[model samples]
Target: MNIRITLDGKEIETTAGTLLVDVAADNGVYIPTLCYQRGKPCLGTCRACSVRVNGNVMASCTVPVAEGMTVEVDAADLNDMRKALVELLFAEGNHNCPSCEKSGRCELQAVGYEVGMLVSRFPYRFPPRTREHVAKYIWLERDRCIFCQRCVEFVRDHETGRKIFTIDDRGTHASIEIDVALADRMPPEQVREAAELCPVGCIIAKGVGYDKPIGQRKFEVKSIRERTLERSRK
Candidate 1:
């Protein structure tokens, strides 16, 4: 079931119907992603994974490989598109990575660094958001959320499949919520899972965070690009 496609001027052979993200990674092409994880349903909420396919911009995680397709993952315009998406997320929320507990390990911050985003192109809103602390093990910091919907879709009630996180309001006023009653019943692993699911610092585990010193945390040691691109160079 091998299919051939061209990526950035090079020919790549991969299985048909394989996700473009997986195909790119297998062929030493790195495409940034946030809301798409292996084995989980893709939300495509964040357009960070966009790549140009046959001259059209598409979310790579949602597209499958096709024979004779020409995929562009490293075009200048596509890179700028990814950068703009990251910058918009920064301007839309109160990331404040320097003061946040998830500073070094935060994916959004790592992505900003990877994309060379020195400053947000859009004006900062500094929008006021309420924090939810009702959950015993996990809490919500609305200001840091990017509405990725990872927890809402993946971290459901272990038994009944009820949503543990949801959204309220609409558009600019919308915010994320945690089902306190259901969250309280979540096992310790699920509590950690929920916190880790967040690409930003919005979802936090009560007893963790702020423990790692600066320049010593996950992404701090090695940037996301280094992790993704270095392997390709090998």
Candidate 2:
């Protein structure tokens, strides 16, 4: 089935069931996404890849290409909306990129720069940090969590063949929680992988400190589109 959609004033036709992200990428339209990787599962929890579809803001990762769909990739309102979302994430977490390890190479930082968010308008919540050292090889910093559930999704559904992570609260207090029973027995490698999958420095490798300098990180090499395309090709 062929589906035709208008993106940023250009008409593009693609096969049905194609993701909006792939469609936009193929058409050279960039949408910043953190929880989405090319070869990975689509966890629509991150609102970063959102776009205006016929005047409605929605997550492009979850939206399948539809015939006659009018998609606006860079509409000013959408951009502002995404920027505000980024700002909220920053205010909620302990990003402090200047002192963190993933600073220059962090996806959250790169997305902030892409959307031109120099400072957050929302007052910082500065939530209390929870440090869990169950793995010893890795430390889980709950403060940096955006509650994207990428780690939970990857660990339980993708790698472990079981659901070990889940949201433990509701509304603004929702958070990613690991099943303590399973988390105690989970392998260090799996924990480390989950930590690495984090777009922000919420989960940090214990001994592996920042290896790259500020100016030489991968995020500095290309725009988010180029990076996403490169990952897709891999």
Candidate 3:
């Protein structure tokens, strides 16, 4: 069954139970996503896809389409809220964009550009976090992690189907933890997949940095919005 919902003042007819984010994207609307991956269970950790649903703020990636639903994806206030969320991530994390290996390819950096974030309004935490290269194939740069939970939910041990990445502690002391044994057992392709799954440079693959030169990176070839919308069409 198909349901009609109003998105950014345009009525769109989409399959019932389809996520609002996908519905909007199918209709050529771009809603920035940080932790949400298409066809996967909603983690709802980043909340970058938050939009007004029936005049209330909700995570679009988690919300299913409903009849008569009114979604405000492009509203000015909503854009400002999204922009602030990006800024908060920047202020909370030590994201040295220019120096980071994921510079041009980082989704956070691309989204920052899309949101027109010149500088964070909030004070930078600059919390002391050490880089971890203990794993045989992975580099753990804790400072750049935004707690997106993508690695925790998506990347897993193929044989055991168990989580290879997880979070430690809660709130301010929270940090991402990896099962070194499971991580080491991961195939080379899977190892690269884990690093690619990361939105930031946090989960870098050891011995793989600056492989793609300037203008050849993921987001560099085309803007995130363009790439996302283009993907939606295919």
TM-score of each: 0.95, 0.88, 0.98
Per-residue lDDT over 84-139 for candidate 1, one digit per residue giving the tens place of the 0 to 100 score: 99999999989897789888888899888878899998999999998999889987
- Which runs in model 2 stand beyond 4 Å of their true positions? 157-160, 179-192, 232-234
Question: So what's the TM-score on candidate 2?
Answer: 0.88
Per-residue lDDT tens digits for candidate 3, residues 4-104, read: 89888888888889988999888999999989878789989898899999989998999989899999988789999999999999999899988899999
Give per-residue CA lDDT, model 2, range 122-228, as digits (tens).
99988776666665455666777788877777776344578766777876677666666666566777767766688887767778778887677777766565787
lDDT of each: 0.87, 0.78, 0.91
Candidates sorted by lDDT, best first: 3, 1, 2
- Select the stronger candidate by lDDT from 1 and 3: 3
Cα lDDT, model 2, residue 36: 82
Between candidates 1 and 3, the TM-score winner: 3
Query: Cα lDDT for residue 102, model 1?
Result: 87
| Best model per TM-score | 3
Return whichever of 1 and 2 wins on TM-score: 1
The residue ranges of model 3 lying beyond 4 angstroms of the native Cα positions read none
Question: Which has the greatest lDDT?
Answer: 3
